[model samples]
Target: MRQNPERRTALTDAAIEVLAEQGARGLTFRAVDQRAGVPTGTASNYFPNRDALLTQAGRRVFERLDPGPEAVGEALALPRTRASVDRLMHEMVDRITAFPSGHLAMLELRLESTRRPELRAVLTEQIRANLQENIDFHLASGLPGDAETVVHLYLALSWLIVERLTLPDLFDADRTADLITTLVARLIP
Candidate 1:
């Protein structure tokens, strides 16, 4: 039996939302069906298992950040003024901080991939894609040498963003800007 492509996509999206809200630990076929307003068998027919559902959700997460470098590059190519860079950095921080579930799912996948060879490859590809996007920005800015370092800085800051939200103190947007700016400055050619 065939499923509607549009509905399958919708189900995957609903699964991501549920995973984000409950973490991987709480994801269930029933919950996804409820979220999608489809029958449980509908989700089971496509996913068949937790891994399949999660893997598809991971791909969709990356899809949402499409044309990654070009998108980030347009923002970077703006006037090289202080205010412009500041605005860019603030926007980047907001966008990254807004998707807690995506971040959480990535973290879980990273850990799980340690024992699952197939998952490790998928995660590796994601890392490469992310690195390439960062490298693109660095290259455009004439800072190719610092590409890997900048990527590391971003990973660290992202972890901090996640952990900070868990604490009583909310994320300080200003501090995040200062950190990224200082890092990017060091990466400048």
Candidate 2:
């Protein structure tokens, strides 16, 4: 197998785009190679099989979606109040929505996972770890929320993102922002 880190990352990123645009059925090595503009067989060299490619794409989506340290620091700088939590929630929605293709690829992986046990395990583990990380951050930041509140927000915001991406006509920006603020205010003590 090739050990070119840059090429591997490119291939996985291309796979993400392919997954988002074409769904699981279109995630072939050739498709990834074409999307990456690499030679045919390039993706196959990096990923042994379709499952490997899908799993890696899932990991890559999270890697692209995870906020940087600067964003985290900024969030931590806010006052520990319900209003601050509301702002944080809005920021999160902005961050997630900023990467539309990454989130769409995530939704694709989720649907694909329902049929593939191995893929299911990988996604479940990654999502759980991300959830726990959010819970830990909320607690350590002295935010106005418990673990349950975080969980509720996670669920609500995740679907809200889906609605925004899949059906933009359903909710405009102001309405979405209002929903997030209301969610945070009601969920946080």
Best by lDDT: 2
Checking candidate 2 for backbone clashes, the offending pairs are none
How do all models score by TM-score?
0.77, 0.98
Residue 180, candidate 1: Cα error in Å is 3.0
Best candidate (score: TM-score):
2
Candidate 2's residue-wise lDDT over 47-99, tens digit each? 88999999999999999988889999999999999999988889889988998
Give the poorly placed runs of model 2, Cα more than 4 Å off: none
Model 1: colliding residue pairs? none
